[model samples]
Every structure is written in C-alpha cells, then in structure tokens.
Target: MQEIFDENVFKKGIGRQINLPFLKAVSTAFKNIRVRFGRSFITIGGIFFSLTFLMSTFTNNVIAQSLLASGTDEVKFLLQPMAQEVQARQVWLISLSLLVCIIGIMNAMLTSVTERYREIGTWKCLGALDRFIVELFLLESTFQGLIGSIGGAILGFLFPLFVNIGKYGTQVIEVLPWLEILKYGAITIVIGLVLSIAGAIYPAYRATQMVPADAMRQEM
Candidate 1:
C-alpha cells in the first residue's frame, strides 16, 4: 500500500501538459513541484535513517577515533568498513536523484506526445514539412521543459531552507540562491528538451505516414 502511494503520487504522469504551450509548461512545472516535495522526501528518508544508524555506530565506537589517533592496528581495520558505508550512501543519493530527474523528463515528454497525436496528423496532412513538424514539437517541448526546469530548480534549492526553517529559525535562511537554481535548471531543461524531442520522434513519424484522407478522418 505504501509502495502504491509512491508509485502513484511521487511518480510522474498524473499532472501533464494540455497541448497549449504555456499550460503545458505549467503542468510540467506542477509535476516537478510534486516530485521535489514528494518524491525527494521519500528518497532522502533512507539517507536520514542511515545517518542515524551511523551516528549510533559512532557513539558505540567512542574509542574508535581515539584508536586511529594512536595508530592502532584495530582502528586501521575499521577504516574500510566505515569508508564502504559512506561510499554506498553517496552512491544511493546520486543514483536516486538521477532516477527522479530521468523519470520526470520521460514522463513529461511521453505525455506531451500522446496528447498531441491528432494535431501532428493534421499538420502532416496539410503539407507541413517533416522538419517543420519536428521543430514545432521541439519548440513546444522546450518551452515546457524551460518552465518545469526553472520552477523545479528554484523549488529544489529553497526547499531545504523551507524544511529547516523551523529548526534553523528565520535569520539563518536569508538568501534564495538564484545562481545555483539557474545552473541546475538549465541542465534539467536541456535534458527535458532533448527527451521531449526524442519522445516525439516515433509519434511524429507515425503522423507523417498518415494518408491525407485518413489523417483528415482521425477523431480530433
């Protein structure tokens, strides 16, 4: 049941673009908002749990650091175990972040293509060039990507501060950190834009193959 919630909520596809460029953008942005606030919290939960475990381990091994300081052989033996756990945690963090981003981009692109199939067919039948059709989708996808990426980036950066606000108090959470947001946003948008174009390829091709009469007959 818990897994089902994660699949339905934190996972993408619920909120999607409606074919209008800006509205599509807004829908994609909302999905990211859901991901950042929802999916990320779940992914980070394990990290927090592991950190707690590590803290307990450290408390139990109070003499561990002291042993290393004294160059004891036993301390040297424990180093590998500590290092391995830390490395594993780092890998999990990076992997989960990548997974979320990939999932979000793929979801947005696939949904966009699915909704615009008939529109693509119509364009193809009206003597629209293949390149034009491709470019048109690319532009719309890019626009959607830009909105989601920018909003997600901002939300991601400020999110930690927002969560920590109660603990850290208002004074410490001063800046919004725009530069970092833009950097990450640019990267995400580029990935999403590319994914959007790639996702459209098959759909666009199918649309291109439609006979004019058949395309005209497709239910709009």
Candidate 2:
C-alpha cells in the first residue's frame, strides 16, 4: 500500500502545465462563445453584405450627383438607376454592419465580465489597485477588439471578391474600392477597441470597489 502511494510512480507519464493570464482567458472565452453560438460569424457575413452594398452605392451616387449638378453628359444614362439601387442597398448594408458590430462588442464584453468576476475579485483582494485592474481589463478588451477588427477586415476584403466571382464570371470587379476598405478598417478597429474597454470598465470597477473580504468571497 505504501509503495502504491508513491507520487513518483506516475511522474514520468504526467505532463507539464501552462498558465494563461486574465486577458488571454477573456479572449479565449469570447472565441469559444463566438464559435459555439455561430451567430457572430453570421453577423460578420451580414456586415460584409452591408458594407459592400453601401460603398458601391455611395460611390456611384456621389459621382452621379456631381455630374448632374455640373450639367455634364459624362453621367451615362444606364448608370443612374444602377447607382441609385446600389446606393439604397448600400445604405441598408451599412446600417446592418453597424448593428452587428455593436451587438458583437456587447456580447464579448458582457460574457467576459460575467465569467471573470471571481478572478477580478481576487485581484482586488490581493492589494491590486482599481485602476490597475481597469487597465488589465482594458488590455483584454483592446486585444479582443484588434482580433475582431482583423477578422472583419479579412472577411470584408475577401467577401467582395467572393460575391463578384460568383456573379458575371469575374471580369475585373467594378465594385469594392480599397480606400473605403482602409477607412472602414481603421474606424472599425478604433471603435471596437473603445467599445470593448468601455464595456469592461463598469463591471471591472464594480468588482474593484468591493472590500477585500467581500471580493475574496466571490466564487470562481
């Protein structure tokens, strides 16, 4: 019995472990939930449609309006209606993309704060300042935002090509401008980073405000 109790007997077969910090933990949680729900990806697809339609529409609309205002024949007869339709679709698409981004950010931040309540409490009890904890949460949020932004960019770029390739046999897509992509990508990343941190701040602050004893009592 004593020989059977030996800890070393199983040591060779045991594996080492790695530790992940709070930020990484939050990111992983969001990643898992996003995958499991499958809605986030769908939202991303919606965003793609919205973004594409809006950009094309706006581009054509502005050109047509300018040409009309200038009293020029440069505006082709066929292009006006096509441009208007594209513009209308684009408006809807832009709106949808904005909605998706808002919902996604909220979901990620809300889930993160809910799951990490105990860990946050522990940090507070261990003499961590509220601001430090807030910064920690912010860092996690920023990382999440960056990841989402990158993913959105990749998807956004590829989506237009995917759609065009499917339609009209890919004879050099007349739609999908690079400038708009750049503008949107930058805006998306900044907004996402801000939204993520904003979402976490309240929950993190609440956790930090509790007394050490109270904080410690939280369940993992």
Candidate 3:
C-alpha cells in the first residue's frame, strides 16, 4: 500500500510539472486578451458572424430534411422550389464569410504583434523562446475562437428555431433533430479553432523572426 501511494504521488508530481508551462502560457495569453479586449472582440465578432452563417445554413438543410421526412407535400412544395438554389448559394456564402473572417483574424493578430513589439522583445530578453511566443498568440486566438463559436452556434440554432416556431408552433420542436445540432455545433467549433490558428501562424512566425533588440527599438 505504501509503495502504491508513493507511485501515485510521483505520477501526480510529474503531471503538475508537465502542465506548469502550459498553464503559464495560457494565463499570459488571457492577460493579453483582457488588455486588448476591443481588438479581441472584433476578431471574435468576425468569427461569430462567419460561423453563424454556416450553422444557419446547416440548420436550414436539416429542417428541410425533417419536413420531407414528415411527408408533408405542401410544406415540401413551399421549401423545395428554391432549395437547390439556396443550397448552392450557401456554399458560396459560407466560403466568402470564412474568407472574410480569416482575413479579419489575420489582421487582428498582426496588429497585436505590431503593438506588442516592445513587450515581445522584453519577454525574449527574459528568456522567453520563439515557441513560447507562438504558443501565447495561439492560445489567445483559440480562446477567442471557442467563445465566438459557441455564441454563433447558439445564435444559429435560435434563428431557425424561432422561424420554425412562428410557422409550426410547438410542433417544430418535435421534428428538430437534436443530434444534428450537436454535430453541426461541434463542426463549427472546430472551424473556428482552425481559422484562428491558421490566421495566427504567419504573424506569430514573423514576430519570432524579429531580433529582440530591433523589436525593442521600435516606438510602438
């Protein structure tokens, strides 16, 4: 029993040691996000809108499927007339929105890097490595993406729910597929995370490439 207890303690110690640096980086990223709340909100807003559009499209498709499965010819007639056109357009619109959001995230991250030149230099001067800097920015963006995606998914789900409620009253809830919502919400979260990470890559790399001395010399 004593030996087992000692082994457990040793494992716990190792786990804490492994997680310490990651915790520090995450905390530092949170501090930077709080400091730049306005810019962070803008980045999140872009993600929110993009994911909202994508999820709303998915919701529409699911609703159409539900309507068809119910064997409601009238409802199907009303929906089917423009379903193909709307489906085609949804692809284009989602792509465009994602492109715009990606650009917004990239711009926001680059601006952050530019504004934090002295801070980055100071961190490097204090033994912070290039990977640490990259991790910091990535963590910050990932947090933003998580928040924005969650908000977008809720908004997207509500949009369709409200519309269907108005049309079908409480009957709408019966046909709505909860599983599909969960699936799409998960996908949206992933997309948000990927877009944020992709957007941060170039800026993080550029920030690391700058000489600490040169970065510190810049006047904001």
Question: Among these predicted structures, which one has the highest TM-score?
Answer: 3
- Write the residue-wise lDDT of candidate 1 on 15-110 in tens digits: 431233544445644554454454334322322333223222322232233333443365457554675575557566655554554455445445
TM-score of each: 0.45, 0.56, 0.88
Q: After TM-score superposition, what is the CA distance of residue 99 in candidate 2 from its true location, in Å?
A: 3.6
Displacement of residue 218 (Cα, Å) in model 1 is: 3.3
Query: lDDT of candidate 1?
Result: 0.46
Root-mean-square deviation of Cα positions for candidate 3 versus the true structure, in angstroms: 8.9
Screening candidate 3 with a backbone cut-off below 3 angstroms (N, C-alpha, C), the clashing residue pairs are none
Write model 3 residue lDDT over 187-217, tens digit each, in one string: 9889989998999999999888888898888
lDDT measured at residue 123 in model 2 versus the true structure, 0 to 100: 60
How does residue 129 of candidate 3 score in lDDT?
Answer: 68
Off by over 4 Å in 2: 1-79, 165-180
Model 1, backbone clash pairs (residues 3+ apart or across chains), number: 0
Per residue, candidate 2 scores C-alpha lDDT tens digits across 1-220 of 7676676556532333123466654665466445545544443343344334444434444334543444224334534567667667766766776666556655655565566667666665554556665665566555555666566555655655555446323332343345755675566556555655565576556555667576457675
